[model samples]
Target: MSLERTAVRQRAEAVLRRLAGDQARLREDQWRAIEALVIDRRRVLCVQRTGWGKSAVYFVATALLRERDAAAQRDAAAQRDAAGPAGPTVIVSPLLALMRNQVDAAARAGIRARTINSANLDEWDEITAEIHAGTVDVLLISPERLNNPDFRDGVLPKLAATTGLLVVDEAHCVSDWGHDFRPDYRRLRTFLGKLPERTPVLATTATANARVTQDVAEQLGTEPAAPAAPRPDVLVLRGSLDRESLRLGVLDLPSPAHRLGWLADHLDRLPGSGIIYTLTVAAATETAEFLRSRGWAVAAYTGQAEDADRRAAEQDLLDNKIKALVATSALGMGFDKPDLGFVVHLGAPPSPIAYYQQVGRAGRAVEHAEVLLLPGAEDAAIWRYFASLAFPPEEQVRAVLAVLRTDRPLSTQALEPLVDLRRARLELMLKVLDVDGAVRRVRGGWLATGEPWLYDGARLRRVAAARATEQQAMIEYAATAGCRMRYLRECLDDAEAVDCGRCDRCAEALFTPEVSPTALTVAQTFLGRPGVQIAPKKLWPTGLESVGVPLKGRIAPTEQALPGRAVGRLSDLGWGGRLRGLVGEGTPDGEVPDEVAAAVIEVLKAWAHGDDRWPSRPAGVVAVDSRSHPMLVGSLAERIATVGRLPLLGRVSSAGSAGADGPRGNSAQRVRTLHGTLTVPESLAGALAGLAGPVLLVDDLVDSGWTMTMAARELRRAGAQAVLPLALALAA
Candidate 1:
């Protein structure tokens, strides 16, 4: 055998020895898989569960590649005047914490390595240059950074030019079937296509099923080096859902007060280390403030936070300066802290995948950590609110495609008017489209780079299947009569369940009670009803009423109540004073009864007559009105509904409340009874001219009819009739 090959074998043997000493040896299947990888000179994709030694395979592979590359450099030098640059293996990881951990491991092994991410791009560039110049041996990078044009076109080309091997950690992300799907991963296929044919790629992931494995292979443009094996035996634990130490319980109270109460209770109890996962940035900020008010050191992390602030907050968490953190999912992916003892979810995540990833942040040290999912009916409402935002409307996606089809670089400022996407979400979507070859990034922005495409039948089928799978998982979580942990494991992968003795069902055998056959039959029948709204109370037999159903048989009342009531209420309240005719304006004596007059006034004032005013109505009211309205509500209802549908706005405390002058509440400012007055003529003139100035105008309601009429009349008189009106709230 060649001397370099012998050295590589020795290093591999040493790694096996060390890992075996720690009682973590690779199984026979794993070893055979690795052998096949090396022998066939083909790519390998290893998918195993958490705690399985997926990393060990790649660590050994990296060592072997390094040695091989080194020997090749020496051979090239003998033929030439001097040694050429050493093209070390490139590892693309999604998590910075994982990157750092790998760097630390390499350091312990006396292997020279460096990590490049958002944290240290300059240093990354310098290290990459050194790698090109034959100094650095291993280069680790987050997939996000690697997908950047500068890195892909500049640094990666140099690495590929040198015949470098590419290793993708957390490779499941490449698959739409994976729990944490990233759009950037699709671009890796393009990167792979650019590499030399013989340049082997290796992917390692802790979680992947059959479909995910297939996706990974397709994305990397290669077949597996060996046949897939059964799931690993890594002592999978189905831990208790009932965290006794956590004081777990649902809070149905108002958000601000309940969140504040939670912050106060735990801020001083934990080891200055906790995370509060919120559904939005605003909530993160508000929760952070609530904790801070309790005299605890805290920080907020979300998409809205500046990069510097986010970095500072992360550093503080690492340094143990901030005892608690309030954040959205944007903060947790790459952060690591083994000593963190608590993770409190302020709301339910949209899917089990999201919930697993977020909650997985805790208990890294195998300590008795606590995770509390404080979900009430409102939490369900919050998730439904987010789900609507996460999945954009068909028209929005079509508009995006239209904008991209212009064959010109569309700047962010220019594209803002075309779609209802947030800056971050839009950027992510654009990147996804770019990776799919549907669009391309040009000098200043983006342009259409592919054929005009509609959703294909196959793609639609795939989406429907995936959505069904997700919905199945959600239903299981919601209604399963077993340990939550066991249910989650079975849903994720149909692995054998280990009895978690601490869970709610296991500890108390609460789910063992046989459901009444009659009740079950009735429930099944009711569930099968096509369109009828069957109340829970209607399910019981007439003579069985004495059994005493819980909570008046209300299933998720808070989430369902408003929608149920709004339909009937809005119609009765009148489409602009129409319902007021039902109740006489004055009593028989010519003086109106207080209740009668109040009811009449409410019916008149509740009617929303304009675009800006619709948000003041209850959740789902706009949708109901659109369906029931006489006018073709097309796109206008969508636009008005779109504003109320925004996730941040939906979660805001004041959602659905009318403006200052609505019937639900009296005007905070006196309404001008006279309509023909101009409060500030210069300000109005500036507004009408579209100048950069604030203007004040008087109106009874910022609703469709009144505000538009008033603004139109005033601006027409000013001879500038095309002015836009802004308002805080509107009457519906």
Candidate 2:
């Protein structure tokens, strides 16, 4: 293709103006990216800061590409065979919020944009048709969509053959070394390989350091036929990682209560509406509730939230109707707000890259936005919890491969019992395996590809080591006594790591570290109040029969346990630290601590007297014998029976290791393990037979709830009217 420089420049300016208003103009870097795509037909990796107009490069390129294609269609004499209108620019976006914003932004440039994501499954066929008809100029899809069986097998080949441009938003996720690496994004390798040879590809991210940038660029430059081939020429445009509008700081707080109090005391003083990031969903919910009680309008946003609620919460934040959205990382990638006022972290994110990506959400369009981190002792624990979910061991992966039949597929649920991984982890592993050629996902489920797959233990270890280093970097970032912005920029390998003189350290402290007594008291009380209900399992896990457990379908109401109560979740902001100390992974078993006993008593008192109290008072207390923490469970049951003036019924007996404490793989395997392990002893049966009211079945913790379920069933058969399960903690 031949083009006049002045004409291309003029066309790009027009598109940019259309996309970003009349006063908008493209930066030289953005223009360079556009030229690379539209004129040079090159693959570009753009590592730019947030709000740096990376999207403008793509939007302008799309407009220019499509317009040139249209001009070619009009001028048949220009070529012997005229190519029809170009295929829609296919964008594999990472987030729904991002896709929505992109669609809206594309429309402003008079580009017909459509998205096919989980939120709009019904419109996928229509969108596909539009793409085929060349009516849609831009099509955005989640990365996961690239691997969808139907889409991959039916529509992807044609789309790849004709796509004019391929844009990968948040391309950092494509690198395992990146802070937020996702396995699904790895599927882009296949998609990139299948793309038309001349198709221009653009990968953009704001959080990538030099390492991640190179990795993503290499992935983009790889030839379809030979991934091992040397990296081809790729246009890499990496700008300064500095966000001029952000003023960063860190405040050392004594506890979660003090941090929440500080937020309640000073949220309004920061800036306009922004976000409060929490480490866990439970913390987000609790923090939002506490803020609401203090008269600040806030809503909790998490991945577990319903689609409608998340949309409403997002809109509330975007419209500035709410003071802030209390959220987890679920709100990270695609959210865009120009004038966000502040971003406060209840706890530090595990890595500086992740921290920068999130805090980048603020101070985009504004002159100044507050970015504060309140580091907690529990942050490391939360990080460890997440780190535990990394790729499974070699043995586990081999077991999964062994179970797969080359001729048939097995659904994840069907495979859960056969493997020792949870549903989410299993699915993620399968996706990674599929990318490695060990397995393939088809219509029914996943099938072994009959290809030799080497376990990349060395690479996995390298990634894990990188994660640990990032975590250490985060710790140093929190404690650093120097320029905060410069520190962050350096972490991203940005050459422009000069002191901003705007942060609390570089300048005078802009925020007071003090928490008002009234706010502190309120936070303490709110967090102190505890009692999380444990809803009983209604139906047995599917494929239980295959696991050698006959149980299937719904649990008969007569044999089912009533909804129970836990003092609090191990992830709870208030009691989590204490509970974790008592029962977390390597903690030694001991008798109940006085504080925990008191907390359990308080939970019982609340359950007995509060609104929606148990239907009836328990007639007796029965302990679920714990092999891991027998003293704790026994003491707790004895104390509760004594305090409530009820009989201490005999404990449920465990026949073998199946009844041992801790997680037992997926639900089916857990159920199978506990199916016959829990039995009502003769003494417990006699006591249950004499009970006139519900019996409180106490345990140290409730994870899968299968042990409790089987124990309850045994008690019900022994003639207890109802079994009310209680636990010291509920695992998240």
Candidate 3:
């Protein structure tokens, strides 16, 4: 090797030792990546499995580049070309947990590291100052940070101009083809184009398949412009995506209750502290609570969790203070615990790639770590619900663009009534539009850039098709009668995949696959327990007036529905499946099922006896005129009244209602659709007036609670003392 090459290798080795340990040395691939970045200054994409030391490549390269840049700054000739030391390494990580782990990892090597994320809005200025002053070595920020109004318009330009190294961690997200695609990560294309030429960039991910790999590489290589120029020399390093330590297995339980019982029975038998992943936040919380009730040291982690709470849970797992954290995909990326000995999935993730990424969190540093999938019967239903949140249809997208005014900005709330998307979906669409230059986010809200934007219906359809294909692949992965590890690896297009003898199919089923009778009974009882409270909506959705409803701000206390009750959430582990079948879309209206009637009676009994019971027993029962499930609603109401022996006064008549049979849209639009639809007839009015107490208003389901609110308001107007909603299920 040349003297210069020898010196670079020595410096890289020193950094690796400090970052890892005294015996740490750069692997050949690591050395090659470091050399390309520090010496050649080339953009590179590394597709390696988790625990492959991807982070080490960037940190070592950062150390070498910063050192070289510092030396160049001191030289008279170099000083004339550049103003100051280049800048801190900017790592665009996807999760706050990943950012925290990166920041801590940097400090171990004596590198000054800091982070800017949603959780630390108060520290951005200080961190930005440190970056500008050349006092920070590594700077970590989430992908979402790239689109922050202030950061995008202000700090980013300067940071882009001087960044020493750009690292896109979990880089698969940049590709629309990836399992966990985020529109915010698409903003990286613009950020990449803004970076000065010859700035070394590295994209790292553990989950990209060949298609995702190609897409991300193309994005990394090409500069975004009117006429894009592709840099064909982008380095792509692909390795075998295999985790030898992970002993994969799938244990199929008969039902949701059986699955929970299996977990309660077998959780202690897992190798060590780890994560129990669920498909939804509700499932995670329920699973955690159930396990805790069974005397297990566990906690729930989800995107809905507070930042401090997530951090605390992360730390607790890292310190081995808890057996495992019951989590959703929120706990998926960038949580570092080398010795996490097991991963248990309560329900199958919709994509095999995503499942691989999540399970990769386990068996990283241990020689033997257990990985199991307890595929639920409701897995497909849960997957379908999440799939519905994908990009809006062309007409909806057009509606969003149509309402934006070039003369002034409109906040999302201002735009809600004009369009039909939910708040979260609306915000996501806006971000995509912003990145496409159709709309721009300003300080006040969002402004139309007046740029010509075509709706890409074909591409959207293709993406949706791809998602369906992936969902099918995941379903196959669960049922495949082959080596589970090999199946996952092959799903990611890993050519080296082979039947692993360690897998259940290849060897013998490692688990007993049986739930203890006691555990099964307890799980059934836990799941069968019903009654999720429905907190009344205190405020009318903003922009109601724009939607033709003459109300805004808080709903009048007198008119608002009282706190209500449901047999269970549509997403509940125990009752969710049955409820979805009964009340979910496409079911023909019919009399209440015997089991459902029993569940409703149980809910009423508990509601009347619980500490938060109504002020007084309802004097009568009143069914909301549900156009979609009228029979179900009427029968349920009759059942409740009969069981309690309360007077079945009458139904809240939908006689004068003037909208579609089933209202659909956002909160404001739904309210607008239901506003004047319902009224009490003269007979029901007289009966309500005669009664002295509140009535139990019944419906098939409570989603958005606007229907209940509107129905209750009418009941109140008709002389019912108060209206309390009782539904068969609460939509999640």
Candidate 4:
């Protein structure tokens, strides 16, 4: 109880030792940040490179701050009241993996840390009680939790009033202009303003350009709306954003199969266990499967993986029990394994800033690590697909605002058909609006604030332009002949950008270009042996009745199309690349390629004998009229009919002008777009009027599947016994 300032410093040093053993000592920047937060109570923004001990600053500062508080209270002769809080540190992190790692690390430092996230819903009440009882020393939470109705209105105020330190990990997400911006992070302003005077706030990020740094700094100084509080002057500590340990390189493979072949042969030669990052979940899955088939110990990780599975995979990787985790961006941020020796990107991310953040995960505590980019020709198409899902257009935002009423809460399900955005995008827009005070997500869903919100068109355009610039920068990085590491640093606006002499471009090529013939054959076989089941839609999308469709609840068994087949997915690692050139978002419609035809034949051959085979072979083949891919669909139908020895029935034609153009929309909107657009041709109707066997319905692809659904229904209504749908690819 009589502890002095010097005593607190010694205790901090001891805590650090406990976490990292005798080798633990704070870096100058870490000590500076800790002293500023604990002594000066000033807001600090640390924009250093990854593996720079950013987490250590917060954990050490938390220990010092709490001890400092208790010592002052004791000296003042103020006994702790029953209701007085333990003055815990609240850390708003970006991912569950981050939270898990932080919580475990904190316990090692003798600092009690707990987390409340989607993964621990069953323990929310228990965690809440612990917080109220002043038992938690540090609380880690996801950004999304800050906007929850019960959390925002009921729990946050108490937590803020008692919080001694606020740490914003991955704080670049606070700025709209940041590469990985999230609107939920902007809600931190409200939380910050509610804190007691002079509460220390620390924000840290590994990826931020000069523009993003300034933007986040400004937001760090923003106060909440009412009874304005004084903003704390932020102390910015930006170090050289370079990893001396990384040896960067670019490997431009000619084709997807070759890339997989390269990985199959070379994965064993890469330094140590690290992450193999892919741009999509399907790619991660397919890559992991290929690697496993080739005798590599690996596991696939994505946002779709269960929480327990992710935890197990993370542990396995940490223990060096596996070769690597084939993962998407899901396994990113706060996954700490000091000896992680390499990071290989299957496809380039959209920006050099993102690439820097990802590759930095390697060589944290080692002298050397390998960072390689296997950029694909299809990278641009994948980029464009994700760009489509960015912040909605201004009109779409206004439309969402128009539907929310002050008196009622409408769940996302209830709002889908009423708006054009899909559920994910719709929910994202709502969170952005919620942070802007234009709407609020409540128990059931969301409600309007009746506030006059400006469109900020100019700002949105600036962000859009910035994205395009970043994308071009990434492409340039992939092709640049200069220092690969330096080019990335320059893109991040690092003031200390210099040639990393360790890179392939800086020295001689570090990796060989040749892939073994056996490896290539194996990769091709895995890629070509393709068949993906097109799961049939069962329940109708809610609010379809409001869209003038008069449909809701279960889709009648007869109305639904039977399970179908596709050659592959647009996001698959192997067939995906070739399929993209033929059926990607902007690719012009064309006849099926000979290669694709052969693959389709293989699919048919397998279907005729595979377990999911149809009850009987089709008696006839029919084409679904496609406004975009008519030739492709017609040719596919003719080829299938000829090969299967079935009659070529006439194609179904569009009877109405209605069509859902552009990339796919929400389910209800897609269904509405094609509900009455298709009609059975008189010739096709007559041919199918007495058909007794299933009809093979051919199309270029199935995106929303509404086209196939509608076509199949029309065929059934025309008297076909059953419909069998087949296509070249399933849009990811």
Candidate 5:
């Protein structure tokens, strides 16, 4: 080997030792990746499990490149052109938690790492200036920022042109086949295309199958713009996906309450502090509250969780101060607690790949960690709700493009009237379109590129179909009589799929299938104690007037519905689970069941008779006529009136309602559909004539809340004192 090669090897060894103590040894795969980046200047894709030292490969590679660049610059009299900033390593990480963890980890190795993300917007200018001055060695950014107007057009191109080593952490997001595909990650292609030749890119992911692996590898190189540095062969290094420390199990509980009861009873018996994964934000909060009620030190976490709280919760877990963090997917990737001792899933993830990624979070550094899945009956329903948020149809895409087809750009807020998508979905669709070159995010907002964009319907449908298949695979994994770990491995397309004697199936099921009666009673009481406050809509949706509606700005307080209550939320893990079966999507509309009516009585009685009594006793009960669930709404109102000893006011007619499904539409269309839907009957007007207090406006369920809003307005117009919406459940 050349003397220079010898020196690099020595430096790389020294760097790894500092990062992971002197006892550390570079595995064959790690050495191959580093050698490729440092010597061959080739791009590499490393597919390995969590705790497999994937970060080490990039950090070490960055160290070698930065050192060489510094040396060449110091010998500037001989090679002055090589003396510039050495192009800081640009890392595209997906999550804030992951970036924070990585930045902290990098600091241990004497690496000066900084991040540019939403959480640190105030610090970005300083960080950016440091980068330009070559004082920052590593810069981490979220994928979404790649398409930010100023960042993309002004900042990224310069960074791309100069980035010495580009790392795509969580690289599976670049492939549709991966469980966590993010459209923003697709912008990597544009970034890759802009990079000069031989930049030595590294893409690392802990969750990806063979097909996803191939796709990510192809993306590791660049576009054919630089013929002088044509893309070299991608160095693919894959390690076994199996983690021996994980002892997997699946316990099939009869109901959501029973599952909670089990957790309440058994959480303390677990080995160490870890995560309790939930499928939704509501579930996370519900589970955390239940566990806390049982005297467990736990905190709820979700994507909506405040950043400071999230950091505190993370610290608490690391310090083993909290028993567990009941969290959504927000806590999964890039969380680096090596001694985490358990992971329990309250509901199954839709894809086996996603399941693996989450469970992989446990047993990473310990000799043993228990992983259990108490699959919910409502997992499929949650999966479908998420699936509905998939990429919009071809027509919606074209509409967005048409609106931005002028020289003048328009912000997403401005485009709301022109297009028919909710803000979140619209922004996401724009990101995908932006990546496809259909539109551009700029100083004002977005602009049309006039570039012909193909919708790729087949690709989307295939992804959807793949999701369905994976959901079934997860279902099978839960019910499989064979090995649990083996089934998961096979789903991930891992080459090592043989059964281990460690899982529930192989060990004759470790967890008991029963919850103690006392625990169940506590859980049931906690869940059944209901009264979910429905916050009244305060502001009229913007652009409603432009869309030919007369309303705009803050909603008239008188027109808004009074804060109301439902027995439970459909996303709740307790009574909410039962409610899900009743009013769930596709479940035929019907009258409220006798048992459910009893629960409603309890909720109403609590509102009127408990410490937090209703503002005023409802004078009477009124029904909102339902085109879909007339029997359910009518029966609900009649039962409440009969039980409360109040007169039954006549129902409001649904005759004024109008709209097509506008399938997969925005909130504006929902509001428009119910704008004039409620009209008071003369009988109802007469009934309200002598009413002295609020009227209970009963409906089968509340979703989007427009129906309730309009009904309340009609009742107020007809002289009702106040309208309180009561329902069996609220769709999250």
Candidate 6:
């Protein structure tokens, strides 16, 4: 071994001694692996799980490389010759947060290191300059950013020329079998091949099964080092899914207000930190405001929220200023809070993988944690909707392909017409295509550089096959009869398959059957009447007047009078009222014309009645009694109960629907229209009045039954008594 390698080994051994204490010194297999990589100069891939000490492998290897460089300088000095600058090591990470953490750790260890990300451009520039100058020893960057040509041509080539080690952290990203795969990762194969042959490469991750391990090897074009011996003593809890500390219940209500009430009750009862995962920003915002009205400290996080707002909300969560957080998928990744006691899914996650990842955030410290998966008819509808989006029409693909095929570079604006997509949406699709190398951006526009033949032949077939596989995985997750964790493990391969007894099915099977009667009934109803379609308006008591209650004269206000009147009524009735303005219109000052407001409320309360028929209006209806209204308090719970048991409904399209010009899945548009109709804003009341047809009302959540109730009444007044409501989840 070289003198420098020997010195590095000595230092590493000392560090290991300190860490291991009286435990046996490094195992023979470990020693052999280390020596081969450091002294003999070989690449290494350490496939291990969390707490496996994979960090030691690279830490020791870097120490040796540093020592070797030092010894070389000393030898050059003795010979009165100038020594070349030492090569700098590069570490490509998957998450910016992880990279920053590593940088902090290295600094504490007295090692020279720096990180590069969108957050620190000036620092990134300085670090790149230092790497070129041969002064920096370690550089950390996200794999996504490494795909940038400017970084590749300007910074990486210099480091590669020097033949420095390249380490890929969270290396599982290289595998399609892994849960997270960035198309940018595929580009690493070509980039790594460009590096000097002798330069060693090291890949590390906390989790990897056999399939993922093999894929990582293929992506790096190298054989993996012998894995460290399994640490059997490490506790791997495959306990029952029952979290005794968590009180579990499901509700079956027909309105969003009821869902909100359930949330408020939970907040009142628990009064601790929790997370509410919604399917959309509008839902998150509405839920947060509802909770706030109930005097709970709450905040919301979603893609639509400004970055500053998201940061503040996260900070509030960390600081415990807010007892609960309402969010979408945007809040899950990179969030760290050890004391979080609960994770409630207001809607079912898009896939089992997403569900697992979100739930994994809880109980990370092995302390008692709880998770709730709330499902509703609308939630199922949302899932079906997403499935439809995933399985886009072949025509859409053709249109996108045609845009990409333009010989000249085309800007998003120019391409939008061809693809029939808004500029923003077109950009998202283009990004996915770019990551797949199906298109390339040049100058101010995009160019169609993808293989044309591949577009139609075997390559396209392969892409389709992959999508089909993903679809199958989703279906299996939704319909599986066995353990959810095991299913996830089978699908992801990288995740451990051990049963987590905490999931609903597992807990029910192993511990107790806490299934709700309402949910079971709804599920049975759906199963029995698979072909039956009922309109939301028809479900309300007003539509059933022929059966029992009297159908009386109802005046429909003009659309122009709706907003002010609805806002006034809700505010007067103490329903946490706020009129989301259009353009710059302010809230109109006046009691909603009494007849219109009272009529809307009467219809809403009648529909919300738990009894089968509408109650006598003047006597049975209570004016927004926040305390006694089951529709407001138990809305989410009731919806959850009813929807959880319902089987998945097939996809439905919203084409030709009035006011449906926005993005297919925009929550804002859905909420605005649904709420506008529910509140009977004169502007919308007229449109709804005397309208008759089978209509489908889609929303993210059926929280309190109020929104759906009012919507049904408006539809009835409009002459359309058949209105079906579809939502992603019924908040529980």
Best by lDDT: 2
Q: Is candidate 2 or candidate 5 better by lDDT?
A: 2
Q: Looking at candidate 1, what is the lDDT of residue 704? A: 25
- Tens digits of per-residue lDDT for model 4, 558-666: 7667888999998887788778778766678777788788888888888889988977888898887777777787888888878878899988787553322335578
Looking at candidate 4, what is the lDDT of residue 5?
48
TM per prediction: 0.62, 0.98, 0.97, 0.95, 0.96, 0.57
Off by over 4 Å in 5: 1-3, 77-85, 656-664
lDDT of each: 0.50, 0.89, 0.86, 0.85, 0.84, 0.50
Give the number of colliding residue pairs in candidate 6: 49
Residue 185 lDDT, candidate 4, scale 0-100: 95
> How does candidate 4 score on lDDT?
0.85
In model 4, pairs of residues that clash are: none
Candidates in order: C-alpha RMSD to true structure: 16.6, 1.8, 2.1, 2.7, 2.2, 14.9
**Order by lDDT, highest first:** 2, 3, 4, 5, 6, 1
Single out the weakest 10-residue window by summed lDDT for candidate 2.
76-85
Candidate 1: 10-residue stretch with minimal lDDT: 562-571
For model 6, where is the 10-residue window of minimal lDDT? Answer: 559-568
Per residue, candidate 5 scores C-alpha lDDT tens digits across 371-419 of 9999988888899888988888998888888878888888877777668
Best by TM-score: 2
Q: Alpha carbon lDDT of residue 650, candidate 6?
A: 15
lDDT for each residue of candidate 6 in 452-532, tens digit (9 for 90 to 100): 423344544554465456555655665566765566555555444565665555666322223345534433332221111
Candidates 3 and 5, the one with greater TM-score: 3
